[model samples]
Target chain A: MSLINSTATEALDLLAKGQITSVALTSAYLQRIADTDDQIGAFLRVDADAALARAAQIDQRRQAKQPLGKLAGLPVAVKDVLCDSQTQTTCGSQMLASYRPPYDATVVARLKSADAVLLGRTNMDEFAMGGSTENSAFQLTRNPWDLNRTPGGSSGGAAACVAAGMTPLSIGSDTGGSIRQPAGLCGVVGLKPTYGRVSRYGLVAFASSLDQVGPLAANTTDAALLLEAIAGHDTQDATSLDAPVPRFSAEIDRPLTGLRIGVVREHFTTGLDGEIEHAVRRALDVYQSQGATIKEISLPHSKYAVATYYVIAPSEASSNLARYDGVHYGHRTDRAELLDELATEQKELESAGDREALKNIDNGLVRMYRRSRAEGFGPEVKRRIMLGAYALSAGYYDAYYLKGLKVRRLIRQDFDAAFQQVDLIAGPVTAQAAFKLGEMAGDPLAMYLVDLYTVSANLAGLPGISLPCGFTQSGLPIGLQLQAPPLAEDTLLRGARMYEQATEWHKKKVPI
Target chain B: MAITRADVEKVALLARLQLTDGELKMMTTDLSQIVTYVDLLAEVDTEGVEPMAHAVEVSNVFAEDEVRPSLPREQALANAPGRNERGYLVPPVLGG
Candidate 1:
């Protein structure tokens, strides 16, 4: 009977029937966010006035008998990586602290078109780097389920907001389990659509090849609803898939009677915490009870997914983030006098940087390129960038980048071969439940291992969804991931919906 | 277990980032720990096991050699910390 905790579908039904106004609904969510956000750190920015204004428009249209989109004023939080025209979209970095984009990301534009109220941007690991939100330069978004524990990141804030009931859904970008891992730890549902399934045109890049935008919501249906609204061809993104967006929600009731679920052998390794494994097993029972067949399959190459992901992700990130030098965008120090005087500028920039990078920057007339790059990027971001530059660096491209490419092909082949024999792949979303905050900070590799179970999907270009299947005795939620072949998002959703309906894990709310 | 001061400087230069001696000393330890942890990869025999690059097999991505609209010069230039009349501004490097 609670209005705030109701699913998006239920909320939409109420709005369509005039049982509630978008203004009222948005206000209610805002009130909840205001009460809980200080404790949860879910939002990096909240524009109460903007949210209400948008909601008022939706209410007005509905009263006038005009058409309404499916969401129709639902409030959804967006990750900081996505652009928000009215808010400064700093991706947890001091460099972009004061910058605001003039245009909304494609997903944001779609949400606006659907009449969804934009709640505000949420916190994330700086440039979506760390597994725990601890890497955020601004704030650490505490896990809603257990504040003492981490909200698995870099979509940490978005996931925490939904789990804390700040919003029914939120948009998050996943490069490597950024959406799903947090969704699992926070006890929410997160969907990582196939790469290119959702447009990445406006997403601030972390790793170009691996980066993707997806939705994190309270339940499978809500997640599906958001996906339906965001998925489609985006002319602005060259690599975006041109396929028609599927009716994700419509498949909620799709029969799973003949589902052939593949239990990935590698997911059951000894490194997995016992209770998490149990939860996955329990969730698997849902399919078995529904007359679906379960088969154990080997993705032997999967053992190396994390290793492959780190190298490739950082390498790509190194390249993609190369644009954020102190010169062109986001963060600069004053002392720059040469920009006005051509001769002075030429003298300064020419000697300032590497010849190759200098070509990209204008220093007086001579132009300096790499020097600005030298100043803008952070150490963690820079380390990866350098690795990428070196990978794509002369003389090493074939040995490093090309070798990585070959391995990527092999990884995809493993998934391709596995998908042919199974309707879907099932496993824990992470190696174990969320670890203590700062536990992995000193060991970046340990943090990356948190993504071992989830990164394979990114490496293979497949759709994966993570839902709270069970909980550890310590009370941490465990995610059961369901992955399907490329463009098989519906299968993953359908499988997840079935499991969700069969369990009460989704109903367990965080006492925010 | 320890990254030398020289190691930190080398990495900093490679990354095109600056670090003070004090920061360098701290990073030497921190970076060394991280490097050691990631060295777990060394345990696995990846011989002939090609390194995976992506989850999907997408190759030769192409764009029509066509010009399209881009963000305005003003918006693109909005985030820069240093800029002057013509373009972005930077610290002096002529001494180099």
Candidate 2:
């Protein structure tokens, strides 16, 4: 296979055998990115010189027969939301367009410790707020399968880079299907590990409770390899799980004995694209042939996932985003003169002993805060902040934010009940395949529905994987999602691997 | 409940976002549709359910009070938009 198209596992084998050097592998990926990223828009920045230097160092270490990390000599792309210290992490928003972190995200640090060459940072929705990646303030990441169509977002660039053969592995974050949705739309493997499975120390927070970091790869095995390397406890992230990290790559090939997969009846309801449902059912049939049994199950409260998510995520986002006040860091408006004028007026009022008038005067600092945010963020981000502020505001907190949390509990209960009878729940990753770039523009409600089937996993803090199942009539890829109980990524990867081994769906290549 | 321009303005102030007249109009319509859609949550019976704050059950994750080297002041303030030698510069908070 060409170096650009080789899976991370295959490339590692070649590198270990001394047949291929990390320099060669990294160069091939960088070249491919340079050639295609202009059209695909998968990356915000590519660190070519630094990547080459790192690869050369890895090659030197291997020549000396030194100890190496699991992902040594492999190239990996990370979403721009991750802080790398070496590159600017923008989160695809103007708010941080020029802001550079002084530290690396836990995942980035992990990837580096694994000896994986950092290829570059990929584009994403501003603060991961939107699904289509159209909310990216910098560039539009188009689906590699079809240029005019969107690569499902906010991990759109992460998935597209892998699908377009720019990189063998990429790291993406999932707040609500950001990884899986785009991976499905791009015909690559994407995994959203359980909520606390990966640390989130330097990841730019959108929704603190729902966000997670995971891998996107060409196959389940690569995803497993990347997951094993990054999944562990970090003192920097208090929510990081202290449990033992399993050897996912080693256990991925083990076939389950009498695997019981649950198909949620609510998932196949109206609004799901017929072709996606058909493809998922066909995947279930493939599993049955492998001695796995499919059983009908119910997650009755899943219907409220989108509703609950919009409220809860935004409420958390509103609170989390309050830090970008232009005082500490990030974009600050140039309104010093305005402050000076306000200061002069206040001094005059104070000298006149007009204490009441001084109290009523507009605070220049508050106006600067408003103007800075308005100038910094994109429309979708502004809208979510507005909605979240409204929901969490004094009078509506109980009605909106608290009520959404209560429903979130019910959603988790539904998953807990269903998992009692089944090891994994299988369903379509999205209602439809990749849509036209502008298809859902100007309509945020329709865009929110794209996450209907996938949000429940994040809500319940379960591990979910999206792998290629089939394709639409127009040739866009369809994804089959398998969700496991919290911290059951071992089972999740094995289940995805079983389906992958039995079928040729994952082997399909993008036309790009 | 339908969101009005007044509600959008109020929320915008709370969020510290200055919206133009055009944005206020658009946000009023968009938020109304989204709020109505998310209102579907009210149909579900969540009586007696405790509000879930976090996915996993975790509490009081305290760390040892050990002194460690912190980020250098220069590195910490490297990304500041407006800063002096010691701290960030912002608009006047207490007027004069």
Candidate 3:
């Protein structure tokens, strides 16, 4: 085993004991990333300079006898979607390729204040659009467990990095299973907190009502610790909760007795692969052994989660993305002149134009705007953006957006009813293990279907988590999802901690 | 009915994205397939059921009326691809 392949908790203990200096640990991971990331493509941009400087600052603080934050000096990878002022914050697209945020995102600033070394920015689906990192415009982040398979996305890179030991902890966003799906495929723990638990001010918009930032780590406790650091309220984000952040790690090891884990009858039906189902069933057995009761419950609207998510997410995305028309912060050029057929576009550009205008302008800018966004964004992003625009258009708004909102209410109602009978929901995190990179490429519906089991939590605005339940027949990892009602991450985490304590899946690492 | 090539092209233009003929053909086929797949929702009998917008029943997620600090002008302008005396520099806004 590589000495560097340690859990976040172990790494912190080492840091506190002075067994490894922050600089040394950061450099070791940076060097490891340098050696392996070319093959894995986990990092979009590795900021060696900032990482080392942050480490040195932490070391200086240690020598000065300053009180260190619990996660101080640990190197954690930031997903490119979140803003990091000192680093190039590209949301894996050329639109924001040169776009720099004037200030760090709330989470990044929090990490900086805690003296954590921001290791680098990990790759993700452009605008967090797809289920595979394949949607990344820059590069594909492969599953480290099986290099040819996808790590799952849009947090694929974060999960891949943690699984491969490139970093002990990484943060990823989940509007609809972006964090948990990747974590499941990569054999790590990913948590999607209740909506508004984490601030979204610095995150590039995808689906505002659904988007949340969370962490991916090797184990449940590490995932909880990372969440504790970033899971508080900020006045800047209206959606941020004003509630106190829970002590996630403190109760992780708490007993699972008396916890009722409901196995969703809909989650393990004809569509789910047998291997993944068996894995989850095995995980359920562990909970039963731990004095937890398992009950079969039905979530009637569960079947509609993905369809509801697609419509609702696209509708929200259509509106939120209206600001990026080669105007405020993204791509720009001189496409002032327009053909008669393009008069509508001309009017739009004129109305929304920022002061970057020169006296003479050609169709070059409109062309560039079209081309850059076309070439810069991946297929999934384009699909959603188009779908969104159509849905939000005046003609289709009621049919699509409004209709989707009502269905969303039903979806949430389904979860509320289920939670009435059970303390929490548990099932396989995904229908299957990680597949080869090209396995589902070019099939957008298939990609969306992968989130069938996970999207309901987002629709319900409930907190959910995916932890390593088992490996598939092909030896790829599978995830088992545990969900709780709003503010019930403690129960979900506790149940996961108990199962993890009984299993060895969390201890397995990729050969890389 | 299947989504036509013209539909795809029109949607692309609305998104301010340019698609080549080759891509148009590909997307036409892909979108038709996706639309057909999503047509599964049509069978769900959603007449009286309201379409869901947000999962939670949150009505208004409003930031308080407070004048918090904005990022400094220079810092905000730091990443602008082009800039002039007043602000971000670009081409003419109107035609003669």
- Fnat, 2 decimals, each candidate: 0.39, 0.86, 0.45
Query: Looking at model 3 chain A, which ten-residue stretch has the lowest summed lDDT?
Result: A354-363
TM-score of 2: 0.96
Interface quality of candidate 1 as DockQ: 0.30
Return the TM-score for chain B, candidate 3: 0.82
Here the TM-score of candidate 1's chain B is: 0.74
The sequence of per-residue lDDT tens digits that candidate 1 reaches over residues B1-79 is 3456775665455555555566566666655664454444454444676655544445676778888889777776676
Q: Model 3, B32: alpha-carbon shift in Å?
A: 2.7
Q: What are the DockQ scores of the candidates, in order?
A: 0.30, 0.72, 0.45
Candidate 3 interface RMSD, angstroms, 1 decimal: 3.4
Q: Give TM per candidate.
A: 0.89, 0.96, 0.92
> For residues A1-512, could you state the per-residue lDDT of candidate 3 as single tens digits?
45477778888988888888899899889999989999999999898998899899898889898999879889999999988777678888867877777778899888877778898899998889888888787899999988989999988899999998899999999999999999999999999999988989888889998998998999999999999998888977877887888898998998766888898888878878898888888888888888889999998877877877888888788678766766457765434432432566555667877335332233544555575566556667777888777666656676666766777787787788888888889998788788788888877888889998888888888999999988877789999888999878888788789889999999987888
* Candidate 3: CAPRI quality band: acceptable
Q: Could you give candidate 1's per-residue lDDT for residues A61-160 as a string of tens digits?
A: 9999999887887988899998878788889887688888888889888988888898988999889887788877788889877788899898999999
TM match of model 3 to true structure: 0.92
Q: Which candidate tops TM-score?
A: 2
Say which candidate scores most in DockQ. Answer: 2
lDDT of the candidates, in the order given: 0.79, 0.92, 0.82
Model 1 misplaced stretches (Cα beyond 4 Å): A334-379, A386-399, B1-8, B22-70, B84-86, B91-96
